[model samples]
Structure formats: structure tokens, C-alpha cells
Target chain A: MKGADRSKLAARLAHDVGKYVARAARNMPPRGATPAMVAMLATDLYSLAGGRRASAVLAELAGPFGEGDERLATARSLLEEADRLEDRLRAAEPAAVERGRAIALEVQSLVLDFARMVASR
Target chain B: MRRLLVIEDGSEYSDFARLYLADEFEVTTARSASEALRMLAAESADAFLFDLRFDRAEPGTLVGDVDATARRLFGGDRGRALRYLQDQQGALILAELRSAGHAQPAVFVHDFPERRLANLRQLYGSVAAVASFDARAIGALLSR
Candidate 1:
């Protein structure tokens, strides 16, 4: 992809992921909707962390921004936490749901922080 | 220093301006189109820095009419129309500014295609865009 296209994709992904994570943190779904919500969130997290588009965009961004290793490490950490939360939520444990919410909030913060860093570059 | 008004639904652009462009420009911010117009009516800015997507903005503060947009373009799907408005809010805001007789140079941090950028310049005079939030690039665009 061209440089402009790459930057556009990276910024769009960052904004989208930040919004999704923030929403998840703000509104925990009701009991009946929890499964669907968790599934959707998990899909987003997985895509953000490991999907081809995301990886490519992040790699391109990492080079120009010179935060390649740190950005990749952060994505890996988020992916692991997302996996653990998905497993725990499968059991329908109340504590697991709370933990998931907390994680979402943390992820949201991190995403915003990353965005700010990118913006200030 | 030249005065630059950063307009967006959030603090990102203004924060970037303050942190990165303070030495070259005096920065002011408005989070909605109405607020920006009001500011412009009271005082002039040498340039504008716009954020294209206003996803975090409240529905009411957005520049376009959602219902009308849905009816005209989205087959009456309000959800899609709202998203469209949010995504294009910056340009809509520019349209408003132009209509209101504010012809200051406007810059966006977006990778707009050549044709689209040309269209914007045609529709709204003195429009420019950069691909990302590089302070140097944005500074150069705004300075011009």
C-alpha cells in the first residue's frame, strides 16, 4: 500500500479499536446479551491484535513512528488478556465479567494513549 | 504568531496543536460547528485544523441533518446516516464556515485522494490535507 493509505488505515484502526473498547467498558451487556457481546468484543480484539490488516498497518506505523517493538508487545499483551477473559466469561462467572470490564477500560486507556503519542509525533 | 483554530469533536487536534505548534501559532479550539462559527464571528483565525471524523461527538452537535441524510442517501437507515454524518462532520463544518463567509485556509489530517482533495479545494477555497499527525507536515501546511 502507499504511505498515505497505510497511515489512513493505521489511524482508522486505532480510532475504531479505541471506540469499541471504551464502549465495552462503559456498558456491560445484560445477562442474556453477555455472550453475544463478549463474542463481538473478542472478535474485535483478535482482529486488532493478529489480523493481517492490523499487523501490516501496525508494522508500517511502527517503523515510521519508531515504536515498533513496544507497539507489538502491547498488542500481544492485549491479545493474551482478551483470550483469558473470553475463557473466563464462557463460564458465566460474575467476577470474570467484572474483570473483563476492567480490562476493557485499561485497553481503552492504552489505545488513547497510543493515539496521543502518534498524534504528537 | 499566526492564529490557528483547531476544530473537532474532541481534544485531540487542539492538544496536538498546543503541544507541537505553539511556537509558530496561537491555537484556539471549538468542539462543534456552532461553537466554531460563534468563535469566528467574534474573532478571526489565520487558519484552521480540522479532524475529519467526529465519532465521539454528540448527535445534536453534528453539522448535518441525520434524518434528511438517511432519507436521501441511506434508504432511511438512521444508524448508517448518523455514522455518515459523524464521519463527514469536518467537511460539513467547513461547508458551514464557507457559507458563513469564513474563508480561512483549512487543513485536515487525512490521506484524501488527489481527486477528493481537489474537489475539496474547489468546493471550499484554501483547503489542504496531510496524511497523518506529523507536526512538521501539519505546521508546513498550516503555515502556507
Candidate 2:
């Protein structure tokens, strides 16, 4: 992909991922979704987007969650997965950007599912 | 480790917070303003997190007679009473702390909307860093 196309894709992916994350984060219980987790995800996304100083602040603001809580773990995992995909999208690696877009869709879907589960409970 | 004092009504919520924050902060929990005051008197905390409503209802000084009517209208549920208390006492407690020569701690108010949080910011915003309940906001305080 051309540089402009790549940058546009990266921005779209970030926007999509961030929207899902915020949606899930708002609905999940405090245990499942925390400010720290949100902050960490923001930091991860920022770092991927080359905002090193901003990422540093976010990293510090992130808090810990219970390791044994399944909901919290699931949220954390999704965030980490999104971060990885963001890395690929940011790098504009040969085949990875397309993969990142695919994963972004998948992650958003999973996050919506997660939000529904919490809502039901 | 940084000392963190968390004032929340529910044990489960406090426990959850402890689990999340224990790695970086030495966490202590209190359920009410009175308990928190006692704790503060004993030792200082590096930062503070307060749930806007505690489980128990304590009489508030600010909105005086209106509290009783509201409590009666709501069937005297402690949740409503406690919210009244939060608005009344949360500010008072912070003011008390400031007057006592304690260095104002980073304060995060949870379980509250931006409007209520803003009330706090209006009162103690200059004396301390008042923020809404976000881990990143808390983290920003910690970073400072």
C-alpha cells in the first residue's frame, strides 16, 4: 500500500479499536474494566502510534486487576491483542496491515459480545 | 510503595481495588468518612480514592433540613442518604485535612458523574488535584 493509504488505514484501525475499547470499558464492571486498563490500552495504542511520552504517562496511570477474575482477564487479553494488531498496523509491514484490519474487526466484535454478556448479567 | 487510602462502601469493591492497586500501592480501605478520618489521623496516605457514596448514611451538615425530606421521600434508603452525605462531607473532609496542615493528596472520586465531581473540583481543586475515577487519572497523579 502507498504511504498515505497505509497511514489512513492505521488511523482507521486506531479509531475503530479505541471506540470498541471505550464502549466495553464503560459497560464492564469496575473489576472487569478499570481506568488503569483503559489507560494501559491507550498507552499501548499511543506507543504504537509513536507517542512515546504520552504513552509513558498512560503506562504509569494504568492500575492492576485481579488475576483470577475471568472478566478482567478477558478484557485485558482483548486489549493486549488489539495492541499487537495496532503494532502491525503501525509498522505497515508487508502483509500485516491487512491482518491488523481483520483482527480489529474481530476484536471489536468480541468486545461487543463481551459488553452484551455483562449487560445480560 | 505508595500509600493509597481507598474509601468505599462495599467490601468487594474495595477488595477489587486493592487487588488492582496492590502491586504499585500499599492499599488501605475504609468504608466511611469517619473511618477515613480515623485512618488519616493515624497515618498519611500518598493518594486517596473515595467512592461517592458509602454504605452507611451519616448526617450531613451542608444541606441540613433538605436531607431529611429527601431521605423520607426516597423511603430512607441509605443509598440516597449516603449520596447526600458524600456531597456534604466529602468537601468537609477535604477541607478538614487541608486545615490540619496535611499536604493535600491526589484525590480521585469514583462512582460519581462529572457534575458531582466538578463540585469537588470547585472546592478542593486548588488545594489538591481532584480528578474523576479513571485509572489513567489516578496514574497521572502517581506519575506526579
Against the reference, the lDDT scores of all candidates come to: 0.69, 0.46
DockQ, candidate 1, vs. native dimer: 0.04
Question: Which residue pairs collide in model 2, if any?
Answer: A35-B135, A36-A63, A61-B139, A64-B20
lDDT of 1 by residue, B11-118 (tens): 656755775688999999999989999998898999999988998899999998899999999999999899889988999999999999999889987756678899
lDDT for residue B126 in candidate 1, whole number 0-100:
94
Q: Mark the regions of model 2 whose C-alpha exceeds 4 Å error after superposition.
A: A1-121, B55-83, B86-89, B111-119, B126-133
Q: Which ten residues in a row have the lowest lDDT in candidate 1 chain B?
A: B10-19
Weakest lDDT window of 10 consecutive positions for candidate 2 chain B: B126-135
| Cα-based RMSD of candidate 1 | 13.3
Per-candidate DockQ versus the true complex? 0.04, 0.04
TM per candidate comes to: 0.59, 0.41
* Per-residue lDDT of model 1, residues A1-121, tens digit only: 5655445445665555554443333444434445544543444444443343233443444444445546445754654565667667656566766666566566555655566554444
Error of 2 at B134 (Å): 4.0
